[model samples]
Target: MLGGKSVLITGAGTGIGAAAARVFCREGAAVTLVARREKELAGLTAELTGAGHRAQYVLADVRQRADVARAVAAATEAFGGLDAAFNNAGLAAMPGPMHLVDDETYDSVMDTNVRGVWHCLQYEIAAMLEGGGGAIVNNSSTAGLVATVAGSPYIAAKHAVIGLTKAAANEYGSRGIRVNAIATGATRTGMLGEYLDQDPGREPAMAGKAMVGRLAAPHEIAEAAAWLCSDRSSYITGATVPVDGGRTAR
Candidate 1:
């Protein structure tokens, strides 16, 4: 559905971001993969290019506006213009009770989750405006919509993501830029695997929270994001579409 589109995917080194990179390329987008890890980004880029997909990698930390601007420029320069972006770069909150969460942990989560998206929106919007229009999908979490079993900083940062989604959507919808966020549920990402490995018994309890009785695959979340970034979701903007398996419905 994204035929010939120029798409940028942040956090493209692993998990849902990596999944989105593959899915977007399969759907015919020329993807620019952005992440902090050069090894992962290089390997993924090579894989896509080897498969005859137009792909490139930019090593960047989204918290820095200069890095974000350079990444945006790379996409537009490589593909001629920007068409869509999946701002999926983010950090998981460090596990701890609210009262015990240290300032360092809180700042890290907020800077990566909230400020990262802010940086992306500013640069991506400028690129889109110049190119006439585009679509953007920010990766918020189910934590964004309601409190969950997460650190306070994570919950707050996610809520900020949804708020930013609404604000950006409202400001740019008239300009042909559609901004939306995905309320992602528990997914079987590498990070989760590590947690589960430490306490295998915790899996069931985590799965039980979702009506589906299981965790989501990275691709499942990626599919939702891909659709949002495509013309298929043309009328969708300023909304938080839940990709959770009824976790919030309860």
Candidate 2:
């Protein structure tokens, strides 16, 4: 799908982001993994390298514009130029009523989930523009399309991601840039596992929301993301693809 392409993936230490890195490499792309955890990034990099895939890792938090810029530059330096990017760094703030949420919780969630994507978009667009054009897939959520049980801040930030994706695609499609987003459902990620731990019933409850009657594996989401970054999805842009197992169908 992405043969010989240079790809950058953020939040790549684990979950959907990490899974996307492997998928992109398996499809013949050289991938650069970015995350806040150096240890995790190193371990994933070693694993990917051991598998005989061209892979590298950059330790950086997407919440910081400089860090995001550095990560993009590192990817370009490693692979010559960037052909694609998966902006997947995000966090779900504590779930509760809007009134119950405090300022700190709201700020933390918005800064990482909203501002983080904003930073990644800015640098990724710049890099892609230099190379002529590129593909980008932002990781939004089902909450982005509709109301969910997640915290108010998380829903708001995710909604903003879709907006940004559409705006970028509209602005750059004529220039050969395709920008899109995935509205993901509840997936089997470390964060989801922690959420399930807090309320064991929450797992089944979320799964029930999807028509598939089960939660998605991170790789499932990664596959769709990879396709979006590939030429196969060339005509697709300025849209939010739903990878929610029909959760939004209802």
Candidate 3:
């Protein structure tokens, strides 16, 4: 539980980010939501506040360092300081063979997925240090842990995320900042929906890849993140906790 804690969440307009916002609020944290979609952030903010949860929104594109800095400043200014963060902003890389992938696709995916976290880590770590300590959960994927048919660029970027997570944890763990990552399973988010649409009958096969025989719900992944960012997981850091429904069990 995160009672009275101040939390910041990237990509908070939808999917796991939005779900995390709700879960954190229900657990009593004042959450700051960040994303490029102003309308979605505004709407989610209103929904959280209306439900009697403390929440706010900042419009930002995580790929932009200035945008991320402003969002981080806004969160600290609003809540006094950040106690936790969920760096969940990401993009679904365009699926293609390595030989056929274009530079544009590579840049878009790497910039948003890799560089975006780099930008977030700088500001979030600084803020957490000032607050004496904090927890951070970066959203990696099952692809990060193993090879997948999803696009080489995506796999490479996610693998970079895990490396970043571990390195940060090793560097800051003693300083009271905990950094970890979650290797998520296929989930019913808009991105996955689009992927499934490409092959109308792909959903079941996708689910079958997991031992649980199902794709994860966004909230289920959110719960894992919340725990990672809470005292309940104080001993966890520099680790890639799998929320993949046993997808990587074998």
* Model 1 stretches with alpha carbons more than 4 Å out: none
Model 2 stretches with alpha carbons more than 4 Å out: none
Q: How high is each candidate's TM-score?
A: 0.98, 0.98, 0.99
Candidate 3 C-alpha error for residue 167, in Å: 0.8
Better of 1 and 3 by lDDT: 1
**Residues 48-134, candidate 1, lDDT per residue (tens digit)?**
999999999999999999999999999999999999999998888647788888989999999999999999999999999999999
Clashing pairs in 3: none
Candidate 1 TM-score over all chains jointly: 0.98
Candidate 3 lDDT, tens digit per residue, 55-158? Answer: 99998999999999999999899999999999999998755779999999999999999999999999999999999999999999999999875789999999
Error of 2 at 214 (Å): 0.2
Relative to the true structure, how large is the alpha-carbon lDDT of every model?
Answer: 0.94, 0.94, 0.94
lDDT of 2 at 82: 95
Decoy 2 TM-score against native: 0.98
Error of 1 at 28 (Å): 0.3
Report model 3's TM-score to 2 decimal places: 0.99
Model 2 per-residue lDDT tens digits across residues 162-184: 99999999999998999999999
